[model samples]
Target: MANHAKAAEYNNTSISSLKGADRVRKRPAVIFGSDGLEGCEHSVFEILSNSIDEAREGYGDRIAVTRHRDGSITVADRGRGIPLDFNPNEKRYNWELVFCELYAGGKYRNNSGENYEFSLGLNGLGSCATQYSSEYMDVTVYRDDYRFDLHFEKGENSGGLKKEKCHYPHTGSIIKWRPDLEVFTDIDIPLEYYQTTLRKQAVVNAGLTFELHDEYSGETFEYCYQNGIVDYIKEIGGEKSFTEVQFYATQTKGRDREDKPEYKVKLEIAFCFNNEINLLEYYHNSSFLEYGGAPDKAVKAALVYEIDKCLRNRGKYTKDEAKVTFADVQDSLILVTNSFSTETSYENQTKKSITNKFIQEAMTEFLKEQLEIYFIENKAESEKILEQVLVNKRSRETAEKTRINIKKKLAGNVDITSRVKKFVDCRTKDLNRRELYIVEGDSALGACKLGRDAEFQAIIPVRGKILNCLKADYDSIFKNDIIVDLLKVLGCGVEIKSKHNKDLNTFDLANLRWNKIIICTDADVDGFQIRTLILTMLYTLVPTLIQEGKVYIAESPLYEIAVKDKSYFAYSDKEKVDILAKLRGKYTIQRSKGLGENEPEMMWQTTMNPETRRLIKVMPADIEETQAVFELLLGENLSGRKSFIEENGYRYLDMVDVS
Candidate 1:
């Protein structure tokens, strides 16, 4: 043993050097999740959200966001301009404090719902963080018959704020920032995100106008909503829903809590049933929460309870009839639930989820009252909705029975030693922590089984192309053995008996046997086809797999070039070129047509080892885009497919990035 006292000295150093803006620059991911395009794009979101919050308070009618060719994002809102009053505490202009100070804002005027109406920036770090992360920020505030111009570089004020006579006729603010390359390297703001976000905001803002001008794409879109949420639901649902009746309800509650006079709540709820719309675009205050929060949870519960109440009043169901569930109702429900609070709590600084119980309770009671009244008034529409609900309930009952029957056979046996034959199972008793690799051909399976970590990795050998769930019904899907084995492995059950006991629709991801379900195929065209088929099936039958980021595609190199003493794996022709440029001696390049072509050792070294292997996460960033591709490429229309292939076939040559 080495001497304890004289061992190599290790000193603990405190990072006191980091301050304000420097802190944001040092830890970019904590602020923006990445130093990539997402971070740069999110910076724009911070600015736009601040402007939209002003509009939320009926201060602005028009807001414009633009992406410059020189790589700057600018947001201008015709609202009460950023305040210029002296803040006695900071002994600085309020506008200066707004940009420079972290977590310094008026969003938290009240802890209760009294002043809950706000936007994306909740913590003091929001806009200040954006400022700190930016290379430079320019501001122009027009208010009180004066124009205030301010500029800052890397969170430091370039000069004092300047006040001048305002020749313009309007009162508002303009903010533009260039994302620092040192902080967010080579990142461009994603226009699609802003476009989608603006469209959503248009619906909720009602009369507000949203404009986007993109210099990179040379595209401009202006969005205005006269009908607000109603128009949005109609457009998204399209002809898929009963076009005649879309129930719209808006309500406000006076101070319900005597002790909490500030906890005032307001709700603007709109809903329509469309078979195609499975989207939940939930907003708290003004910030969009992708997964929803307390508001969504409350609305879902209220909807089920109220629907059941309506059914009982109309004598539509027997007392023994089962209560409706979210699974049965979600597909047909197109809902917009917006909650305004004077105060609210978020799960984290990300502000992705709201946790206020009051918003949930308020939404539940309000929607129930509105829905109950509508059901009583519109008898025919109520019957139409009830019939759909009943059909869904019956389907759920059949599915649950099917599930119970399967569980009865496999429940006691924690180790599925004799239950499944298609898969070469791993020794992992904890199903959720393991990984499942779906490979084509038994030969490929042999390679995976031999190369895999038997403790946590399992292999399933699939033959040819699997059934496309998009073209097949839920029941027909489970009848196929391939899908049945898959469902058993995933533990996410297939859907109800819509017609037969085959629909594999409903699935709970929590029960998934594998935390990561990877589709491992060859690096050939047929392999691509197999991967697409598998993805299409999962995208349709178990969409939550993709939504929850559990789905992945294993990237196997197409070519392995052994140059001199070193080996380089290239997935694309471009990569091949890049690799060849650095080679100095004779090289041998081997193209792998299938996994069978590679030996077990090679497979383990190149594609199976955790440190060396690459896995592409299948994220649901744009579900609509995914769905559109599925419809066009799957079995929807052949002629349209032909036209699309003829027009865009060459694009496939460069699609090496996808796999």
Candidate 2:
């Protein structure tokens, strides 16, 4: 077996062009950033988003989604039906043109005819993209007393638009389509996902009722939040607020610049210092942002500044006292921020983050003013809040010192890698070729050190399981010696390591010490638990490493079968059986209890040799699913974990060991 790089430069590459729907199918990841289950989910959201945008633009308020049993989805909204009148510009019905054209929609401009003050779809690739990837799409629109129907097969018009009388007597839009199996990996719309998304939309867009009927599951769910973000905060963060500091604020500022289009910005924020962490979700035009942008940063800054200012005014601390940090502010802050921008700039094609520069200044001013008013009106509660802030400030100060000390102690230096007793590092300074193997115990580390290509591979040993980061905070990660050592060795410092003293989310990935991070633990039960801990830590703490395909697990052999003079490694019991049957000879089988039990040469042959070794790549196909599993198993709750073990523990009875 030979190992090669997929990213190597190939000379004389031919330039090509992919146009129309064929272009979308050729490079799906260019539009969706993925072709996995997440892409399928996004397809559903892209269609639903158009309907949601119509409601946002002062249309009908009801939006419904149905998950059919035959791998089909139907999204219906009682919103203003898509423009059905003939378009003189395109020389076709507006409805047909909108569905067929790639970059055709009402979201681009703000004119009186088809003005969209707030919109989720700006690329004009929402329903059209869905239609392009679907086997067939059927669209029905009703406006006044007329009903218009249009159909498409893989984004092309099946025939032409048909007009008829409206018997339903309602003005709305219905889009029904089944994903083309040839184009997608899977088309099944997950029920739990739809339920959560619909509920979240209802929370963001108040007065809008969202419903989901999963025919496959034979269940119906609906969401209607009249109080909107404020109510959503209380529901998730609980009614009991820290010092009873619970309130909502609206930041509405109109822009009337002649150069720019007249824009109405709606910034709705609900805040509660409940001393509990919940779904502190951020949104812009109802699109959920996993890594929040300017608005989220602004809100956090405002809370820290305003609270610190209020405390200083009361003469609670000396001028020399340390200012509060984001960790201090966010520790107890349960918030829901919904920013509606008439025109928005995003960092990527997925629209995961807003890059608007005005959001930071606009939001910070609004929040600061609101907090100042809250403190002045409720002086007693303000004192209680100040007390908690003092406690947090003390903890943060102590943790900061400890974090710096640990960074120096583990790495023997702060920025550059220095020789450490525990880590047997490689010689090469090239980051790309460098590999870091985190082994379970000293024995496995010794084995790795002996067998490894010393020019590239480095080994660090852990005594036992490191903290499961799913349940650990920055303080826990900073204070623990083992966790600190691991972070220092990796050089991708956990949350507490920031040059600018920013929050965990701002931890820079460019500082990563190694190009490849491989878990080389023992082949046993305890080793599996250790690997799980390391995986959870990396997945939650430094997700960029996993997303960039730097994380892997070395698969050590489970059994060594000696037949005659040669030995063959078997990864599973099935493989062992096959090897024995094919050899047709009496062989002695030794079950590998641990990597430590194997010889250095044996370890190299079975696991370390890159050419033939089986390295299982840990790619997080769906991060949301991965997070849910980790939380359920590694969270503070014992009941859910216990129930899971009791019901599914048998699956692990015949499991293979890991390296």
**lDDT scores of the candidates, listed in order:** 0.77, 0.78
Candidate 2 per-residue lDDT, tens place, 250-291, comes to 646544344655455778787777654534778998988777
What C-alpha RMSD separates each model from the true structure?
A: 14.6, 13.7
- Each candidate's TM vs. the true structure? 0.61, 0.60
Residue ranges of candidate 2 with Cα displaced over 4 Å: 1-16, 110-114, 243-262, 400-659
lDDT of 2 at 527: 77
Best by lDDT: 2
Model 1 TM-score relative to the real fold: 0.61
- Which candidate leads the pack in TM-score? 1
